[model samples]
Target: MKQREKKELDTSVQGIIIREMISHVTSEHMIGQKIKNGELRKKLVEPVWNVPDGFLLTEIKMEQFEMEWLEPESCTSDRVLLQLHGGGYVGAMRNAYRNFAVVYSELGHGMPVLSIDYRVAPENPYPAALEDAVCAYRWLLQKGYSGSQILVAGDSAGGGLVMALTMYLRDHHEELPAGLIAMSPWTDLTSSGESYQTNFEKDPLFGKTKDSLIYNREYVGLEDPKNPYISPLFGDFTDFPPMLIQVGSYEMLLSDSVEVAKKAKSQGVKVRLHVYEGMFHVFQMAMKLMPESRQAWKEAGRFISLFKDET
Candidate 1:
């Protein structure tokens, strides 16, 4: 791993420096870099470090394909939480997101977690990723799990996927999950949010740039990026499940979460928004090192525990 500069090592600037190093090593911008260098892709197979004790991992097959499943030692309830890993619709797999899911499952006292290995972009784009999620949840239901027993969750692009899946279900009148939890969700693929420009310099995850917006165009292919399925912030939130949204103050998608929350509230959907200061996109990923990451998980644990009580 390339070391970041001393000045850039400050936690406030750490996100920016990480991008600088990525750009330096891979010679590509952040948006396009994920696809070219497989930055997030290559890490997906690596086993998660620091998983809590007593959580057993198993590999389960779907249609002759396998994905990771984290089975906890005990179940606070009969529910399962399905996680969609985020890599801007182009990267990430079950292994990459296992740590958070496993920890959440463990914290919730062993609610089952089945994180998907959904198809990614450039190779599989647009509805391919969305369809895979829908299919995975449907498969789970076919296995006898009710919709109310599932809580959908993800971070960044995966966060967006959860919302999209809910919207898809609402559109088709199919069974949707009980609730959703998103971390720094990239809800507006059109990149029209003012935060995209206002937070450009401060947001190390993604700055305001037409280049970053191009990723959406590439993934969605000139389709209306504002389509409800493409941008859940632009979708109807009425009758949707309760949502817990957490976002860093400096990310370009900050407004996306805020706007989504506002809409969810307007539509009478239960919504809670937690905005952290001096944080950068999906800070929870650094749980072992970052204080904010720990706090984020703590909050997630509390929120997720509610489902068990309800059951």
Candidate 2:
């Protein structure tokens, strides 16, 4: 293992205010109330739907799911980013991801982004999201984009999905992408990581809850929580592509990223893990407002650049 560096907590005014705001607004009770009142989607979408200028969005209908392509005004790179969004495996793709897709495209050196609205849980459940991911990857392959020219990126549950997707590809003899980028991945549905207790009170969004956000029955659906396809922390990482994982120190799922990085590294995978102190889960969503978030995205761009030209 490499020597661990001490990281300073983000004590910026914006960081402090944002953390408080998230804790107050999206606390477990507030989220439950929002879901009950049918206002969660709107509330989540309103703040992040503002797509930056100079990007174009095109919607495509798959056989069972929908995907949107976000292209820059003058994209010259052949590489593409397949984006899986995070909403605890239950939330549908919204305009927030459209904005995120813009960031991925611009920061990924002008490559186009394909963001999917994969099927979610309680209705679609376990294998549905995974199956949809496979379909999207196959679509890209059929469209003549080699797996080497693709990168898979996601946040939260979507982050875990990217790993599961890669594992599935490897197991089924399909080609893998050039790399992966996961932000605060929810890799362990078992909720066994020590951070679940250590950072419980510090996690802004999920601190108040006994279990992490995505460790619910809706998605697991009678499947083993440790199933590599579901949890991914239990998955094999042999022959996996280079990966960049970013997680916040204050998140209950912080150990999810940490443990996965350790496992991948042990299995001879190239892994870069960044633990940003004092930030909350998926803080990259605040890239426009927080310095730490911006730095995280810049790191993502640099990671993407490493394989953007690979054949």
Candidate 3:
């Protein structure tokens, strides 16, 4: 095993303020309420509905879900980013993701992005979201985009789905994308990582609950939590594309990114694991307001550049 190196970010005032805001608003009760109330969840994320200027969003109707194409006005690259939004398998794609998709395109060096509103749990459980993701990928392929011309990216549960999607493709002998970018990915549905304990008090969003399944039960249903499709942390990374995994030091899912990096490296996959000190979960979403978030997206752009010609 290679000696693990740490990449830390000195928390900025904006980062600290955002952390406190998240901590204040994201109580266990709120989480539970959001899970049970779809309208409430949608309202909670209403502040992030603003999509920056210089981007065009076109909604495409899929057989079972809606996929949005977010393209920069100056887009020149043929590469496409297949984005999966994070809401713990219960949240749908909202304006926040539409904004993030814009960032993905801008930071991904002008590559257009296709963001999906994959089916969520409680209404549509396992295989539903996975199936929707597969449909989006196939749509890209059918549009003449080769596998190598695409990069799959997501955050939180969506991050885990990125791996699950890749594994499904690999297992089924389908072409895989050129690379992956996951932000604070919830790769372990079983909540087996030590960070759940160590960072309990430190995690602002989900620290109060030791039971990770509080956010996962509806999705897992009766299925095994360790099932690779549900928890990619337990899956094989052999032959997987180069991946960039980013997580925060204060989030409970820190170990999800850490352990997955170890797992992927062990299987000979190229992986870059970045741990931002004093940051919270999925902080990259604040790229417009925080320096660290901007830095993270800059790193993503660098990573994407490496495979620009892989197609």
Encode model 2's per-residue lDDT on 45-157: one tens digit a residue: 44445546877778899888999888888878889999999888878897767878888887777889999999987788899999999999999999899999999999999
**RMSD after Cα superposition, model 3:** 4.0
lDDT of 2 at 86: 89
Please name the candidate that would achieve the greatest TM-score relative to the true structure. Answer: 2
Off by over 4 Å in 3: 1-9, 27-39, 42-52, 210-214, 309-311
Clashing pairs in 2: none
In model 3, what lDDT does residue 160 have?
96
Clashing pairs in 1: none
By summed lDDT, which 10 consecutive residues of candidate 1 come out lowest? 1-10
Cα lDDT tens digits for candidate 1, 72-117: 6655558888888887776647444777777767666778788888
RMSD of 1: 5.6
lDDT score for candidate 2 against the true structure: 0.86
lDDT over C-alpha atoms for residue 145 of model 1: 87
Q: Give the Å shift of residue 136 in candidate 2.
A: 0.3
For each candidate, the alpha-carbon lDDT, in order, equals 0.76, 0.86, 0.85
Error of 1 at 4 (Å): 26
